[model samples]
Target: MSNIIKTIDVTDSLENLKDVCDIENGRIAGKIFYDQAIYEQELEKIFARCWLFVAHESQIPNTGDYVTTTMGEDEVIVIRQKDGGIKVFLNACPHRGNKVCFAESGTTRGFICNYHGWSFNVQGNLVGQHESGIYEASDFDKAKWGLKEVAQVDSWKGLVFATFDPQAPTLQEYLGPMTWYLDALFDNQEGGTEFVGGCIRSTYDCNWKIAAENFVGDILHAGWTHDSAARAMLGGSVAKVSDFEESYSVNWNGHGYEFALDTVGNVAVLGESALNKYLHTIKPSVAERLGEFRSNMIGAVSSCTIFPNFSFLAGQNTVRVWQPRGPNKIELFTWVVVNKSAPQEIKEKWRKGAMMTFSPTGVFEMDDGENWEYCTKTAKGRVTAAQDLYIGLGMNSRASDTSLPGNVFKGQLNEANARAYYQQWFDHLNAKSWKELPNRNFGKQEAE
Candidate 1:
């Protein structure tokens, strides 16, 4: 254990506003960039307690269809039962703790443990126990031994999520004001957005937060970090002060905001002419159906991090599951969320757009990889790792908004959303349950 980690005062290291807030500062203080100890606590406090995305409803549409993955460190299998409801359970066997299902994902009428032949149905009910003669009914309570269920499982739009903490709030309550914005993106559509296909899986050598933060708040990197790639794709140089508009929003359970430039507008300026022509041709049709804003974003970049770990980038049309492998490593599950009923041609277009923007070989993805690597490298240094990180962007810019809850700023690029995320993160780290959060702010904002 001694060789396993180093500890830093997160509270103290998080104090210095200027240095912490400056992107340049984050570039400098490298310790927190990738620390194992910080990652461990994140699993217990953040991933375990918060609502981590599991799979989209589209992934498991029919009864008994399932997908296996991890929520924090606990392996989980989410299945669509016969009744059309969703259930999430530990993918472990009740008998000997062996993994019950080894396949990554598939439809299953039920599962039987390979080690002991203990069988369980999709509902997680233990149907049979091997060697039943020796052990009486009293030996194992089938009722008590049903595969351990996740504490809470819920869906927002078509996205499914699970929590390990029994006291965690329902998905809607936890999303807070962000729900309104999410609805605009996901629900306002014809049938809500469904995932395009199976996820795009990859791994990163940096802290999970690096990916999360970059997805949600780091819109400043596109033009430069991706400069060469952008030029190659567009056949021209990226504009120095690219007119990309950015914004941020915050929710109670650390949910964060992102506002991005319109896809057609930005892509036309920075992408190939052929791609731009295709986008322009399809623009009118999409705008006619989904309306101008969303249709305009058919390939535009929009994104948000719903606290803890679920992040989606709209411009890229990629929904990401940042599963913490540890403090310094994370497994990325990237899925393209689209309307299940979209025209086959449109779906194909969306797929192509996703491939060009966020796929493993995408230019944007390559740019991010470079930065994520550098961010993680800093933590290996002894002298630089001790400095505090910052979130003080547009500190004075925060103002209460009647249009939106929490706090809102006129322009989107401010760090108020990031600060709000940390505030909620601190709350979760300290509180044992959701019951504590309301008392802390139960009616303070409403009372005011």
Candidate 2:
């Protein structure tokens, strides 16, 4: 926590925002899915304060390379500077607030805004203007008219992140124990991971949290929601996720995942024999590099969500940032991840495998968006939004092993992660500052 008071000023009270989630009693209010005021509060408290994924280091390896993304509704440009450092800037030009960069990603020497011909270099410095003589004698200061920069920018194993709040914790401190689990996906090999190609973007008519929470720990839905996808890909075999032994949902801070140590079970679901074999062949190497405990997660049945709306499939290797378009909609950006050291063929297989299973039109991905959309659409009803949704499954259950790094619960069907996530959500919304936020998720003590 910072010594400075980093607080969100959502002064107006919302009638439906109160008691949206009661972690103590395992009650989840449907209004969390779609409430205008709650959504605005989230933008102020969560997105503006927390570290959000912006772009991968692999995406922009050279100077002047850039990518455009969003922090809540504020569009930002992530560019590689001439000094080899990365910088994130608000995409709007200071001249008239028009977007300086229109392309999602490409190499650029500088941003020349068509609105006023205001030119900014890759370092986010205003270097030129349409006419130099007109403003020469005026009181205009070119130095103060550069693009607005984000407060912090950093990366963990090639995954770049940025935050808007200057008083927020550093990227490493924010990640905490979540990095321990993330190693399986990011640092499984010596070279670490990189995005395979450009991302696949799609629009979803759903609250971002609905899709995020699904990946966080809702493994129970895999059997029913994606049954057709399983039948289509796995030759009519569905991996039983309900009571799987050696599987757990680990919650740390607001990040969480549900996983089964059934090695290659997820890879097999890709319906690709080559990819399955490749993952199987690398098990010993991964185990030696990481550990037997962590390596077992490779090609396993798992899904994870990092705090607010960043999600990915572990074995499937598709990363997603569920960008909030509004309370009732999201713009999902999808990318495939592969170990940088892997062979070209292996990397290609991983890319295709992820696309086959988790891309926008992929079987599993197709099954999820509609359900989330309907769940969000239903919350618009006055009676429906007021009612509490049941999240009492595995209620009062404690992890048999408190030695785990986080709040780990045995079984994939538990809603413990969902409860913990909402706890964090409410904590962010209710706290006066980041210093006041409670952090009891990671500890030796069992979660009550």
How does candidate 2 fare on TM-score? 0.95
lDDT of 1 by residue, 168-198 (tens): 6667666665665565447545677877767
Q: Candidate 2, after superposition: displacement of residue 436 in Å?
A: 2.7
TM-scores, each model vs. reference: 0.83, 0.95
Q: lDDT of all the models against the reference?
A: 0.66, 0.83
Leading candidate by TM-score: 2
Q: Give me the candidate number with maximum lDDT.
A: 2
Model 1, which residues run further than 4 Å from truth? 1-30, 237-253, 261-299, 399-402, 437-448
How close to the true structure is residue 173 of candidate 2, measured as C-alpha lDDT?
75
